[model samples]
Target: MVFDGLTETAVAGRPAWRHDASGVLFRRVPGGTYQMGLSDAEMAALSAHADASVMLDDAHRMRPIRTVTVEPFLMARHPLTVAQVRHWLPDYEDDYVDDDDAAAHLEDEWLDALLEALPFRLPSEAEWEYAARAGTTTLTWRGDEAPTEEQLLDRFGVEAEVAATENPFGLAAMGSLTERCADRYGIGYAEPAPADGPPVVRGGAADASPWQGCGEWLLALPASRGWQDMFTSIRPVI
Candidate 1:
């Protein structure tokens, strides 16, 4: 199958697409309804397992575990890479990802051009969580198990290898990089979004560190919500 000039295929039951021009693979997320926030139990467990950078209060943003229904959509298997950006903007500069080794750091100014030139756009906050969960109700797509100290530390720094873990939906690196989303973030899910508040960002950057104020482990959770930053990247959806 082909959409937006990309070739699609089914790999091990999950559907995926390859943008030959940019070498970006997109995974198809099936439409369905699922709870979209952290449960009290999950919040407690995550706080216990995370470092001091994590604050119990921050979890309030993901509260009131509400059900969200999403239509099927295609999301980039990995965060947008520098190479993929260059494919659309040959003279692209700023933070770069070499040979798909890392996710590119971009600003919204670039998005204006890219969106006009390509068939991609940022995923919505709901779509992101749904895709990240990959049909799992656990704390992570991996499961509800508490992460060991070593496992939490592993997400602290960025490595050349992208998508270190693949979820059940065949999406890669869903949490490896903090990603830009299409929704504005509010104090809580029920609150109306503040006009000047930062837009919602999802996932943990592979190059995260403890000093960033938010624990890498916390940012990596599927239900975790974050705000945009200089290092925030994106995973395009269609």
Candidate 2:
């Protein structure tokens, strides 16, 4: 879980930064305008079922279609692990019953580190989708040749399971792992807080429930403040 020194690069003539932390290399993603949101097929899938429980509706967690614009920024290449977050805020407190609880407690420190390390903030629902898509127009980032349940299961090294095609960026688990997805307007995830709080994690995890990774959109519940976990522990984009 050791992090190497920061590596520097230039984007659009501006100095960009990247870091290798916890065996993942986070590279700065120069932001630009891109369409976001679910595809017709996805919408149809949600609408095909009239039962509110299985339908895709805003009240039921579906993001309404919309247009959005975003500024350039950086993001982590992968989900932040417990070991990674512990690097900076060794004393991160966990109030929940399990690792999920620990994730919630360390949120504040995570934000703090992110702010200190770069001139950016967490990707908005719109931003998250734009990046996850990595410039593609498909149900999931992977494309129409969606992975079969078997393929996805194989990737996870588990029993047979369904798989959503990844977008062009090689970002697996966007639809399967995380609910955050691009709509006609932009990217969005389930808001972590009911009133006000930091953003929640976007991608799904291996430890989540089977329903968590259903072909439907995936998103994590928000737990703590961004600064609580010393963002250093979370992944960072160059």
Candidate 3:
């Protein structure tokens, strides 16, 4: 019932995210193959239901719904916090953008320090969705369609009060906050990653409609790329 630290009960039966020495929390994702991306019929149906405010011009970017085989890995139970990032590498800010300028701006020692200090890294696009799906076929880990404002508050609570309640996999905020993903990809499966394609932030934030969470995914620029919002956070996988 408690998610404070790694427990035999939590890790023995299912993969779990528990407190780490650095104060970060992580869950285990057992390896397996799963469908990734939208199907034609689902896309058409989703497009019909898509809200005008959150319209995505390119749904094809996540298409072809391929079956991906992943290796067993550990995932952050919650999005990485500014405090956590700073703990491992003191200079990284909470809203540090992961873009080219930011990367270039970082002290040469930061990356190496990050690699050495923590046993975590960002999750790939495929790995992210697979964990988000958590063995479901619907748009959300919760349901098949967009949810309402009431739905989100009731489910996870603001500030992750009830974050550990629903997701069977024990990974937090897959449908709530915009956490960082590792892939630098473009709009279509066939389209090559833009020479400038930035990594993506997955899941929906509190400010947006809960209905949008199932379909929300925003892109982030490289390092301290001033494009970050309050809801932007990091969810590293190892």
Candidate 4:
């Protein structure tokens, strides 16, 4: 979604910059008070489906709704891509390799950029939920039910085939793309160690299962600090 020059200026201290590798652009998301968490319908849906999918057990189901406030920052219009990330840190060759070499190399660049951008770094678990919720109070952004196939495909592109529903901000395929929903505190392609496995990249030229794309869940991984085989998509907070 494109923003007006004035809105862009208000949100991002500077004008938006487009990355050379990926056409994906970013706009500043002005932080403000937003209701965070799932609505009653979403909770009911999760309760109804809990027995069918291990992923939806009560423990992991949507939590109580809460009011959250965020400061202004930049968020990528689309997820970060392999090509764009490489421009900043070229040492990463394998799309899924997260190791000491990759982390050490990319950390400096990532940290520098993040610090310069805003008082906030990446969205924490609560922050991501608040932003993804936009202004809604539902389980999946679209509603409790999964979105239609056509709707899913439109938002996620190739990854839509696996998306169960769209989030409040129209973010699709979040859960299925392991990379998108995995650990919330890692940088670049790295997944911290001791996770289920390396994080999977989200968005861009990949397929995920419909069940995996549910907005209420998070894709687990073995590591939290290194690269993964999947492609990366980003939503940067300016």
Question: Number of backbone collisions per candidate, in order?
Answer: 2, 44, 16, 33
What is residue 114's positional error in candidate 1, in angstroms?
A: 3.1
* TM-score of every candidate relative to the true structure: 0.82, 0.51, 0.66, 0.50
Span of ten consecutive residues with least summed lDDT in model 2:
220-229
lDDT, model 1, position 27: 84
Task: Name the runs in model 3 displaced over 4 angstroms.
Answer: 1-19, 47-57, 89-117, 150-160, 194-196, 207-231
List the candidates ranked by lDDT, beginning with the highest. Answer: 1, 3, 4, 2
Better of 1 and 4 by lDDT: 1
- Of 2 and 4, the candidate ahead on lDDT is 4
> How does residue 109 of candidate 2 score in lDDT?
46
Tens-digit lDDT track of model 4 for 112-142: 4533542323444444555555555554445
lDDT, residue 51, candidate 1: 64
Query: What's the lDDT for candidate 1?
Result: 0.71
Candidate 1: Cα lDDT at 40: 72
Q: What local lDDT does model 1 show for residue 182?
A: 85
What's the TM for model 4? 0.50
List the global CA lDDT of all models: 0.71, 0.39, 0.53, 0.39
Backbone clashes, candidate 4: 33
The lDDT of model 4 is 0.39
What are the per-residue Cα lDDT tens digits for candidate 1 across 133-236?
A: 99887777777664332343222125323334568887776765778888887877887788788879887635464434345556678888878765567689
Q: If both were scored by TM-score, which would come out higher, candidate 1 or candidate 2? A: 1
Where model 2 places Cα greater than 4 Å from the true spot, the runs are 1-5, 8-17, 20-24, 39-41, 45-55, 58-63, 92-120, 144-167, 170-201, 205-207, 211-238
